[model samples]
Target: MCTQPAQTEEHDVSTQEENLSETDTALKSIIADVLGLEAATVNEFTPETGLFGHLPELDSMAVAGLLTEMEDRLGFIIEDDDVDGEMLETYGGLLEFAHTKRVEA
Candidate 1:
C-alpha cells in the first residue's frame, strides 16, 4: 500500500511536469508565430531571457496580436485586467502565466 501511494504520487508529479512542458512549447510557438520569428530563435529562449522591452519585435502593437494568439491557441481568455508587465518580463514569467491559465481552463 505504501509503494502504491508513492507510485501514484510520482505519477501525478510526472503528469504535471509533462503538462508544463507542453504549455512551454505551445507558448514558444505562439511568440514565434506572432512576431514572425524563426522557431530556432524562439527555441533558444531561456527562462531568464528577457521579453517585452528586451525584444525588438515585441512592441506595443505586437503585444496585442501576441495576446490574441495566445488566447486562441491556448484556449484561455485573457482579460484586459490581466495585462501586466511582470507577466511579459521574462520567458519564465510568460510560461508560468500560461501554464496557470491552462490549468485553470
Candidate 2:
C-alpha cells in the first residue's frame, strides 16, 4: 500500500506565519517605494505605526498614487469603498488589508 505524509496543525500554522511575514515585508517595500520613503524607514514600521494623517508624505494625492502602485505591484484591486481611514490608519491595518486582497486575488 502507498501512503502519503500527513500535514499537522503545527505545520499549517507555521506555514501561515511564514506567508504573513513575507506579505508584511513585501507590503512594506511597496509602501516605501510608493511613498518615496527609505526601505529602512518602512521596515521600522510596527503595528502601531500611524499612517494617513500621521505621515506627511502620505497626503490625499499620494493616497491615490499609492493605491495605484499597490494594485500594480500586488495584483489586487481596491474598491472605492475599500479606500477608507481605518485601512490606512496603521501599518498593521494596511498589511492586513493587503493580505486579504492578496488572498482574494
Candidate 3:
C-alpha cells in the first residue's frame, strides 16, 4: 500500500506564521501608499500603533481610499458593515481583519 506522510503541526504553525508575515507586509505597504507616508515610517508601525484617531494623515477620506486599495491589492471584498472604529483602531486590528478576510476569500 502506498501512503503519504502526514503534515506536522510544526509545519502548519510555521506556514501560518509566514502567511501572517506576508499579510503584515502587504498591509503596511498599502497603508504607506494610501497615506503617502514614508515606507520607513509605516514599517515602524507596531500592533499598538493607533491609526484612525491618532494619525493626522488617516482622515475619513483617507480611510475610504485605504480600504479601496486594500480590496484591490489584497483580493477581498470589504462590506460596509465590516468597517468599524475598532478594526481601524490599530495596525494589529487591521492586520487581523485583512488576514481573516483574505483567508475567508
TM-score of each: 0.86, 0.81, 0.86
TM-score of 3: 0.86
Candidate 2 lDDT, tens digit per residue, 2-69? 23357575775687678688889888887888778899988999999999999898888888887888
As for TM-score, the candidate ahead, 2 or 3, is 3
Top lDDT prediction, candidate number: 3
Q: By lDDT, highest first, what's the ranking? A: 3, 1, 2
lDDT of 1 by residue, 7-93 (tens): 588887788799999999999998888778899999999999999999888889899988888899889999888889999999999
Clashing pairs in 3: none
- Enumerate clash totals for all models, in the order shown: 0, 0, 0
Model 3 off-target regions past 4 Å? 1-8
What C-alpha lDDT values do all the predictions have? Answer: 0.88, 0.84, 0.89
- In candidate 2, which residue ranges exceed 4 Å CA deviation? 1-11
Lowest summed lDDT across 10 adjacent residues in model 1 is found at: 1-10
CA shift at 1, candidate 1, in angstroms? 28
Judged by whole-model lDDT over C-alpha atoms, candidate 3 comes out at 0.89
Error of 2 at 54 (Å): 0.5
| Consecutive 10-residue window with the lowest summed lDDT within model 3 | 1-10
Q: In candidate 1, how many clashes are counted?
A: 0
